[model samples]
Target: MTTISAGATDPISPGVRHVKRPTPLRESVYEALTEMIIDGTLERGRHLVEVELAGMLGVSRQPVREALQRLNNEGWVDLRPGFGAMVHVPAEDEVDQLLAARAALESESARLAARHATKDDVARLKELCKVGTAYHEAGDIDGAVRTNGELHSLITQMSGNRFLVDFAAQVDRRVRWYYTPVAPVRGAASWREHNRLVKAIEVGDEDKAAQTMREHTEHTRKAYHDLQAGSTAEPATDPDPAPRTRRRRTT
Candidate 1:
């Protein structure tokens, strides 16, 4: 027997209707705040006051507080007694490990997609690649990054492996977090690799597809390290400058 409580939803016309499932307000708030943090809208080190977040998200303070506590437990936010909450700046090791996990999962997805991809799947990937390439050329880094995530996610979908899909979903947001720093630096070369990957999947080359995806992910990982290095260390040069050529002619 199906029971609909009067409080379940707003009044509807006196006819049969399907009631959509309602998400818990706290969980919805958590997702919204986490997404803001992952996408850099909240930004690393940005203060998260409960009332401010509540007003911005159009939610009550209690839900926002609960969401912040959840983010804190997940290491996405730091809650302080007096200072409210702040977005946690990811450590180098944290981002590296996240990327490594992403690479492992996505490579499997690529391999499975290679064996399972239909012509339609390949065409969809190509269309997304075109859109991403256009965004990159137009200097819309955010748009390009979003399209890039979509292409990778579509590959996971084509894998037809439910477990892999679930695992990918777990890491998806954190991958975006690490990717944000290197998105502009990666630009066209990244999309070119995606094109190559799609071609491999289209041809049912599992080994090649997996290897390409692995290498493509490694590039992003390296780009992130390079970004960190640039910020913290001086650029390296030849340890020994070539012996100053004796200027015999000048003498």
Candidate 2:
């Protein structure tokens, strides 16, 4: 675990981004915290202290409080009446539901992309694949994850369906949260799969694109489960663990 401290200058971390005061504080706080959660900087099941978060972002506690409430409403935070907020530890069933949803949505997107993609769109995908493969070979996990997201997002955009793009956006972060841990394990093979998907779309082979994407997502799902099986500590469970902190009741 990285030692989180105040007034830190770092490119990437949980709360290293000190919100510039010019922006709307609450919304900025919300976005910052959400990014942290999605990127696994703030791991699931970790307690979130408002003061600490404020110190991290160099903001007042009020904005942090508001952001946590919003996160709770959106299912990213678990806010108990007595307990403070904890990053929501997703249940195994919830992970399955979201991953399954991703597979369905992305497969359809691939099919539609094959039908709608132009030469420029295919060029963009090949570029992403090139950069992504370089990152993977260089052992830059974070770079690989970022490029992987760009590639998938480009495919979704190429689908030419606004609704599909909107739907894919909703699940994108959660999908990244699940995908990050298993990325190294998937390694070069994942890029190979992406190349196959790209080829299918490039050739306007709708069925092949759809099927390739489905298999690619399924491979990620299998990797996640295999990781869980091998690990002694499971991050997710059938039923989520209870919130870890409790506020004291004062008379």
Instruction: Encode model 2's per-residue lDDT on 1-251: one tens digit a residue.
Output: 88858998656776676666787889999999998998788888999999999999999999999999999999999998888899998877788899999999999999999999999999999999999888887778788889999999999999999999999999998898888877776766778789889999999999999999998898788777766667422233212233322211111
The runs of at least 3 residues in candidate 1 whose Cα sits more than 4 Å from the true structure, single-residue gaps closed, are: 1-18, 231-251
Residues forming the 10-long window of minimal summed lDDT in candidate 2: 242-251
**What lDDT does the true structure give each of the candidates?**
0.84, 0.86
Candidate 1's TM-score reads 0.82
Q: Which stretches of candidate 2 lie over 4 Å from their true place?
A: 1-23, 231-251
Question: Residue 58: error of model 2 in Å?
Answer: 0.6
Residue 217 miss distance in model 1 (angstroms) = 0.6
Give the total clashing residue pairs for model 1.
0
TM-scores of the candidates in the order shown: 0.82, 0.81
lDDT agreement of model 2 with the native: 0.86
Residue pairs in steric clash, candidate 2?
82-247
Error of 2 at 124 (Å): 0.8
